[model samples]
Target: KPSIAGKLDNIQGDIWSKGFPKYYETYYFFSIKTPLLNEKNLFSQCLKNLSTQSPRLISTLRMVREDHNRISTRRKEEAIKQGIPEKRVVLPEIPMSNALIAFTIKGLQAIQAGLQDDTSLRLTDVAATDPAFFAGMTPKEVTALLKDPDQDTWDPLFRSTEIHGMLKIGGSSKGKVEEHLKNIKGVLKHGTAIDDVFQDSPSTPTDSRVDGWTRPNDRGKEHFGFEDGISQPLMNGIDEQEPGTNANTDVNMYTDPRLLIVTGDTKRESSIPRPPWMENGSFLVFRKLEQNVKAFEDLTEQWEKKGCESKEHMGAKLMGRWKSGAPLAVVNFYTEDSKDPDKAKEMNNFIYENEVCPVSAHIRKTNLREDLTENDKDPRALRTKIIRNGIPYGTDYKGNENNTKLTRGLLFACYQAHIEDGFQNMQVNWSNDSTFRTGHPGQDPIIGQVAQKSRGVNGDLETFFNDKFGVRQSVKFQQLVTMKGGEYFFVPSIPAMSDDLGM
Candidate 1:
């Protein structure tokens, strides 16, 4: 509502007030065996309690702009010492514990038992309510893109029937996180949280990929050491809390970016008005992607041994950005140590048409922002955006690959308004299609799903020694990251959770 122009602040509290809380997070999956009434009531009451307990909620009169001048002055002095531009310094606030929950179709039915008529239809229709959610990802007819197949051939957990619901608990510190988990454990026990709660669904986490600070100084980076989470589309309608006010309702919101990247698709008849309960909500896609660190390291070592101009470019072309988070199009070189804050200002301000960065580069293929029509600000690119909010789970191995037994990877989570247009289109129409964005650019070497035999200039989108020119020496990359567990869910707004949806 803050971004809706003349409306009041979203009273449910901005989900990002603490700005990505918890250094450690756990995705607690659950299913129910209790009566439908008990499950629904328990979840509803818990939400009411959580609404008030959500960390850093903007319900005060002084947190808004109260210490802006004083804080800005301190920030400026700190920026000078850190060598960052004064305007870019983000003031740190002590974070607190936060919690959120999501439910699948089976999970929803277990709760809303009475939301049915002769056919048993619910008042609020969520992703679980739609057949498409259970159908999972597929090659949409027009898009003609390949998708992670719905078979045992793919990861079993990702097979629609694996996960029911996930309770995500995060806190500012390890102690707080553990404490929150303990409290939630108590709440979820004795048939309140679920009918039968197992610690995990796909058995216990065997080899965890959880680690810390994958950046120069903890910028968003993946375990592979490449900087992550750049080029995120601005959530225009949502505004942050300011000082001296409970929320930024009448103040800072005036200047909040008004460009909404996730608007409702008016062209899609079934989704024109969207569901009333789904107005400000978004779809949450979860994937438990496992990364083989040693394997990735081996690939890099191979490239390093064959020293050449494009040796460094090899890694950059794989992701479209250097490990330092600098985009290849902007830096024009693979710099391993440049962590300049200024680079972020234009991290997403370049294109790869002339092949400065290969067309099949991971970033270019997923975004296609400026490549749409040579126009940098293409609205078409906006529709395919998703807000990624994943966290690195598990820890690393102890020794070399030979003596290691650690399992680690990313808890890949992304929010989009439309599953088909946002997540599906990117995977099928763009990332999987070598012919997309440019002529036969090849598959996304990072996450593309074509079999090795299908890989080529057209079908598989193999990585060209230099894809810019018609290079014949194309390297077919194997799948390093594997999809182990996945689920499609709807993250309802606070109002939808409590009042509008009749939870």
Candidate 2:
């Protein structure tokens, strides 16, 4: 038997055990050219070309080891130079460049069929079992199921074009990422035996390219001026402690590895057996959400006028956390994020039993902690756990709340074993459901969408500011975050890509 680290080396993309150093990233969505000449052998040859370039692809285990080596090397150099022990030396995190690739249902079908002659070839037997994966993201039924906006409002590439696959390249800077992307395109074009097999459409205005990056100067904060990615679930085998924090003591924050990976021993409510080809693979959900900064600020201002304590309080209630990454469940008033490292580590060590965080708050709705019965809490947590790996895109707001010209928001992405029980369940059953557990806590004020409505409805968005005073305030508002476009993809393990697809 191989170790978990060795197995992870065969899995492409970040596993969220340790977050990737992605300061900047470029997402390239392209379609495989139809009517492929010699389609039988052409597709396999193309995959072989990609497999030969595997050395350029970063695996989850390689990322962890490289990050560890970088830190250790820095500590050793500092110890020698300063005449101190290595344990005493501390350094800031260093960023690294990486690349990953994933295929949509259509792409996988095309590869499996080997020829474009058969339109009936389906991946239902050999691929993922989730119906959401088989039914692409833009279908009318899927839109209604997920409470998404009309397809007409989405980017043309995602709404109409048939996206076969995506190539993601990330680095410490924009220039480095761009250079790497150039190299990847070159390899795909010339190295492959087939020419023009995978090409971006020329008719599209956006060129099927989306650029993303962390907010400059203020790292770890989203365009909404709030700390993001603070309360991620800690995997059992891949991680011993939560990054940016000390050892995770909260039982609710830890997750079993079986919940994330596809193995023969994996068991779910569904009867479908795990495919051998997808042993270590995971389902990927990609969404391009555009945030309206000025509109959110304007709404906060309106709430302040309507008996709310303050704009910061209203924002905190909506998100379940202060802008400084401090959870409202643990703290009272909003203040500057603590500069002390010890205080920052304690931020993610609380549950929602205190009622300080609203039931309708974005985080609370997404991850319910101890809000249900003892028996239900643990089971529900296991069902909805997802590893979020996303970043901010576009520039920060420039003071004008009404400027529609400047577009900025999150390029949200998450990985999970089962799509139906994970992201979809969180969106449809939790976030969008007003009467989720106890109170009529309305929709998630930030990203939750109402059926057939262009905006969100927070019917009972309420929170208790002062527990002693018994003062509870509620406010209603429309959603600020809008889903521009998205898709569901299956990222294969490196071995599967090389042996199965490349064959």
Candidate 3:
């Protein structure tokens, strides 16, 4: 059907190659679980037949600048044949296959009040969209829609208010994620509040939660054994910079410069303009997180049987990387030297201001990039940048962690424009802050939510390994990532979700 009407004009891949897409991909997470039913053409013609099917979006203006100018001319001919002094490398994309969707301001007013008594759509067709998507906004906008992460700080099996929208199929074949879930079960097999929000249909629904991806060598590792999507950010703008121009801005910092600059792009007008039919929309922030892989391999194998320095260096110092994604501030503790192979393509380039990678690690408290750039005006550290696209539901051990009874961990997604300036200011000011903006570096000992001192906000991660060793280091414990369910979505622009909520 002209390739399913060319997926209503593509555009979904981001977060560096479809948020780390590549290698036998086959994820599917869906979870609408019904609610808002005033019956507007059953969830707007099942999201306008999921925007006419070829929808595994692909429109970020062909991510390439001559493949980052041939990997920066092969890292300047391998740094002038190994004498060193040539680094910055990026190639970023290459994967694409689609199925994506996201919505929830109660699923866009349950499809704008299910197409508002259809005299053919109006409310000024979504009431001039985005006053933070309608009817008098301001519930303090977004700090996770004012908490309810499962009644009192999480783990009621992650109940953050019954999900209303999020389909996200993504492929690389498990029969292309079941033919994009059989075209979303033939658009919810003749909908009824959309087949009671699809629990693989038969009109199920009462409760459901799903998360997938585990093939690319067990999805490039995150079942708590390190190696995940790797750090990300970059969107660049220099009148699209000339001269062999190939500024890769890793999956262009989660895109959506109001689609692609000011006919829609005008950086967050005092925070909440985004909605010229949501130019290439993007704002999901789902999270279900649950990892405990036998308490992360029994506290990193008791710090590798007390001969400490090898549970791959205590999971590379609580994840500043080194589960073979490398980057414990330029790869050490466990090793990565092959004649300085351009330091693993400058692993998301470094910095912690000589703190030697430990401003609460977990990618240096979520993206500090070039240490929030000296004076280049770091938009509050690039508005708490995010672009992660999660996957890792369950099953992990043979020593290989938790051999599942379902309910494993990590489905933590993210894509931004504003979920309160990127995932609620990096989950309440940097993974539950321990005095950070630059170093007091506590909490975030691998996805901190708070534990041990239980809600005492002492997930402990302070450090100072050696500056004349005045001594100061830590690695406390508690909820090794456990927020059961979450949501806050938008994902528009499959031709503005088939022309503004398919009205």
Candidate 4:
């Protein structure tokens, strides 16, 4: 048999650390599959629980193909230039595990409606708390109402409207949004809807329970205000999705070996034991991060006059990318050449020499090849590579200026082999590491904090602009890059969900 490395290409794209391109919704979590006599029967039933509005595998393939078209054209061109048949550039054909599922309140409503024949059980309470019952209602006002513990405001969103369906590329639409999404011109016609890529949900009994899910205004932007999700890790054998790789190599540029293997799969000289379910599963962190839009805007304005230039430059410098998702690490100050296709190869082809692109920038800090040097003494950064899986939750212009409303932030979910070594340590240590800050050994400018009493946006945006000033002089990161949210969950592999007493 071929080595596991050879079988690497056989693994699906979505299961890897970076994640697949699709929308997702998180349903209420169920206990690990229980080991019982009825369990085998439930396994089949559980599989039925997993449903999607779109053909999972097909939608995934379309996304992968689109990505291939963008990243592979250059390699095809290169092969042509080298006097070689472009067809020789063998690209890997891989399937992506569909991480998204959909089971709306309407779906549940149908089930409940079917069960209405039973007069003893009242469906009233179930209908009342379900968000699907009120599909088009004001989610904000409804959210406030729902928080009142006594109010039952979730009824209407669950009552399925034809428009509230998932828009498919081929099949007939299912919901209200699905129907409109299909006819929305450039939006949902081609392959999948943009929102679908970022908003798909797991099929569970609780989806219809949502008051209404909203996308944050600053969602596409990271903590530093740059558009994110531009560069993702491509599995080595799977296919190259990131910018640079050509044919043989370029088609596989995003595959970073550090993230390929699960924690316990490989032998370690240090002898750290990988957790029990570490191999096939991933750990996710769902944080309700709240951003101070007004404060962030003001800081950008102040930094601009001090030579940071436009919002785009400051955004790129701080986030290592522009709104277009171009990384400052790869192309500093947004050069036309970087976008010229010729120079836009490796996303990591960055020159860290200049302070123009701050070392404390979110992208650089999160992916510091330097800080991750000691994987043995502390596999902190290396082990912290969890797949970020949640979407921006909240509304547009809800709390943009003032109004005291905490409008938006990420439902920050990250999947990892080990939670302790991954998300937990990264947030508590690296992201909060003052020493990791580029110049002043200051707090990580993005997610770091100053004392609670002295907390607010850093007053001196200029001092922290470049690494010129000292750490003490740097402004404290007052923005909440992430915030509190609901329960923690462990997503299981299909097998795990069906075996071992739903542990």
How many steric overlaps are in each model, in order?
A: 22, 1, 14, 50
Candidate 2 clashing pairs, residues 3+ apart or interchain: 294-401
Candidates' C-alpha lDDT: 0.53, 0.67, 0.51, 0.39
- What value does the lDDT take at residue 193 in candidate 3? 45
Summing lDDT over every window of 10 consecutive residues in candidate 2, give the lowest-scoring window.
459-468
Q: In what order do the candidates fall by TM-score, top score first? A: 2, 1, 4, 3
- Which of the two, 1 or 3, has more TM-score? 1
Candidate that beats the other on lDDT, 1 or 4, i.e. the better one = 1
- 350 Cα displacement, candidate 2 (Å): 1.6
Error of 2 at 472 (Å): 3.8
lDDT rank order? 2, 1, 3, 4
Per-residue lDDT tens digits for candidate 3, residues 1-503, read 01112222344543332232332333333334343545335555556556654532332323323233444577677777776766333223333345566666655655655454543333343333333333221233332333323345444323434345656665444565555555675665524444333344444442343546663345456787665664544333312322322222422433333332112333454443433665546666676677777777787787667554556666666777666566777655555451232344445544545655566777777766554444354455555566576777666654653435545676777776655566666766776777765547676677656332344355333432322232455656655666655656667665666664445
| CA lDDT, candidate 1, residue 337 | 36
Task: State candidate 2's TM-score.
Answer: 0.85
Clashes of 2: 1
Better of 1 and 4 by TM-score: 1
Across 1-503, the per-residue lDDT of candidate 4 in tens digits comes to 11224433223223343343333333222221222343233322433333222343222323434444544575577687776655334333332223322222332233223232432222343233222232322234432321211113222222223212221121111132233333332222222211222213545423422212323344244443444454444434444344453211211332243343333233232244332322333334434455556666666676666643665566565565555555565565557844333333345444355555566666665665444454555545554455564555445443345566536555555555444555545555555555654455444455553333343344312224452242222434445343433322333333332232123
Which model scores highest in lDDT?
2
TM-score of each model, in listed order: 0.74, 0.85, 0.32, 0.56
Tens-digit lDDT string for candidate 2 (1-503): 22255565676656554566668988877665443555444645555566567455434556645765676688799999988766446555465577777778887775666644443333664344667887878789999998888888886667744677777777777887877766666655533422222234745534667889988766778988887776666655555664435323333344455455333336566566655666777788899999988878987788678655578877887888787767777776655553222355457766677667777789888877554335454465456767788889999987854656789999988887778777898998888777775667777888777765645444322232332244665455555777888999887777777665434
lDDT of 1 by residue, 1-503 (tens): 33542222232221232234345565566665434553345654554454444443222112222223355577779898899877467656444555556666556565555343312324244433344454544223211234453345444434434345665655445666556656665555535545333334535441121222222244355767675665555434433333322221212222222222232323342542444554544566777777766666666566666553354566776777776667777776645333454554345545455676777778878876544443454334445657676776556533375654466777887766666756767877777776775568777777776643443434333664463344544566456565555667665555555552443
